[model samples]
Target: MLLTDDIIESSCRHNMDFDLKKTLEALLLSTAEPILLKDVVKVFARYHQELSEAQEAIKGEEDEDDIAIEIPSLVTQAQIREALEQLTEEAQAQNRAYRVVEGPNGYQMVTAPQFAEFVRLLRGAPRPMKLSPAALETLSIVAYRQPVTRAEMEAIRGVSVDSALHKLIELELVIVTGRAELPGRPIQYGTTDKFLEFTGIKELDELPASDVLSNHQIDEWMRRSEEEPEEISDEDVGLSKEPKPDELALDEKFVEVDWQRENVESDAAPEPESNENTPL
Candidate 1:
């Protein structure tokens, strides 16, 4: 039989002098994480030793059932599990949910993961800043690959990205610190402290909200995009109007004009070698 309140009250009033409620509350609140069975037993030993000393001072004997003595210490695994189940049932009866979650070496109350997104929608606070589609895509690229060169970021996004990057810089979400050592020394970009605060995360590792795409699916999508045929414009397909040649033709002398290209390859073969490479 477990020790009842009558037994505890009689013992404390007659022989024992300890404040059992204070003792129990102290032990329960001390645990930052879930208390294990072994640890519970060890804490029980210490409490029991103290109770025995107090009992001897008043000349009282130890009782058979340990609940009276045990209530002052950390709870055993079985006891905690039973209490949790009972709490869960009581919560369900009232149309509420209760959870015992382990976090950072402690147990804490938390809402179910499935309900998190729904809660977010219910709260519905507007974001601190609004971003254009291009700006959003540019920010994502910088986020995933930080300290990336401007050219590298452009390569991944398949765009010039200059205006978007400039906009982000103006918004103070992205920063350009220094130049890369690569040829021509392109500039490098990375997110700022403002970025983390705006995204509501303390660190970059917390960025992913969910896992949906598998690597195989991503690879297949990329391969299909590369293999797809290019679409021709309406003008190229002969659907739109074409201007009369008379209106589009260049002047005769302008057609003969030769313009110099800055980056033209000098090692290429000359057009006519027959005239000894066409005297300059």
Candidate 2:
């Protein structure tokens, strides 16, 4: 007989625990990519399905050994979050070489930074290449003010982000989210799950909002830009309209004003041996 899988209240208290943390640890170990809380619940659901089948198979039969497994009937995302936190703490307490981290997508187990050298040696991988200062600055703008356009990033960075933005896209840290509903319908860029992974955060909201570039501040900046946009000129972008000295016309008094009638010593013959030999 299956008991009700509802929440129970205890007057005194019941010492209860679930294998969720250990189950999550196993899932994280086997999973190649970060596993979402929903996916984790699906795994448990599948187990319940199998258990139901087993119970049906042994109905009204003389079974000495009955299949008995206990777990929460309904697992919520909060429960999964709590379990992952426990796993993380357990790893820390045991001084484990690996730890569980919640990435943008979900949860994953990664090698600890202290053991990074050993892991790198095991994989024979080189040290990771770092983003250039220009790229970092460009990425910061895109991350904070995501669904932004190239022009918007340039407006914030005060320079063209073509090269830096291209590099970020190549690195899969940024992606084209969609097109803006503006005059040109510029393509909007946003940080990717991989970007969150790089930054060691669960989401964009987890990014530490700095005093200089908080979300509200960025929003205000955007609003002001639409209301009172600054005029950008070629000079602002390191361009000049001044002509070179060669482009200036020479004065006719000092310089000869011969146009297409300059002294032409006749066309070169197919065989100009006389000119080649120097006429006597």
Candidate 3:
């Protein structure tokens, strides 16, 4: 005998030993990385299979109709999708600090952007080794426009990026991937595994869409720059000066002088003869 839809639904409802939504939530929360749909489905199927076997053992041999009624049916992919959707909506409705987000690989639980300041405070200020603005811009260009060349980067930024490229290479965020097939065969720059690790992304495709500056936006920025007062000094903006080689050498000389003075002062030296007789 074939089992009816109603019977299958009723059996599933009665035999479900675990809440699907809660189980999914727990699984997502337990891992920092995104979880794949297939993995989740496997777990769901296992639960149904175990429940069906337990029911069969308890009920003993039965007719096809009876077995069908006693054993719970496996969950459909549709049901799993529905559960994920409901869980996502519920998290939003409850104003949760974290929510399920669709990443490049799959779905992941991530903290809300609104609480970033609080999270930063909890984690303390960024380390001194954090990338500089120029380096970050260079990295972004490399990420979006991989297999790029130094000349191409300079053309885009309208400035030489020798130092920025050096810093990125030192940090292991960028690497030289083969050379371009151009005249000079310039070395092409691409991101590295360390870049993905630093960015907390599983792959390059997961990077956020690029926000290219429009011509109007560029004009507006130029206008704003023209409107701002000129004659601003680096010192006024609290920017530290980079020490020059000559300045460093002078500093070393000053340190030696101080050390010599300290040594002379500490030594037991005889005093000069007094001029009291001439004054009298």
Judged by lDDT, which candidate is best?
A: 2
Per-prediction RMSD in angstroms?
15.3, 14.9, 20.0
lDDT of 1 by residue, 1-280 (tens): 1334444454465345554334433454565445443554566566556555444443343553443432344346576555544544554566544344433223334444456666667889554478999999888877766667877666666789999999999999999867888999888888886787567554677677423233344346556767858777778878976566566657522244233542364436466548766769
Clashes of 3: 0
**TM value for model 1:** 0.33
lDDT of each: 0.60, 0.76, 0.75
Report the number of clashing residue pairs per model. Answer: 2, 0, 0
Residue 154 displacement in candidate 2 (angstroms) = 2.1
Candidate closer to the true structure by TM-score (higher is better), 1 or 2: 2
- Quick one: ranking by lDDT, best first? 2, 3, 1
lDDT of 3 by residue, 95-182 (tens): 8998876544667787776776687788896643688899999898888878889986776688999999999999999999999999
Per residue, candidate 2 scores C-alpha lDDT tens digits across 1-280 of 3332221221012215446677678789996788888888787776666555544555566752553333336667788888889999999899899988887788889898899999899999999769999999999988877789998788777889999999999999999999999998999999997888888888777888686666688778878877966788778899985555577667522456565454342333255456766767
Higher-lDDT candidate among 1 and 3? 3
Tell me how far the alpha carbon of residue 80 in candidate 1 is from the true structure, in angstroms, after superposition.
22
What TM-score does candidate 2 reach?
Answer: 0.65
Q: What is candidate 2's local distance difference test score?
A: 0.76
TM-score of each: 0.33, 0.65, 0.51
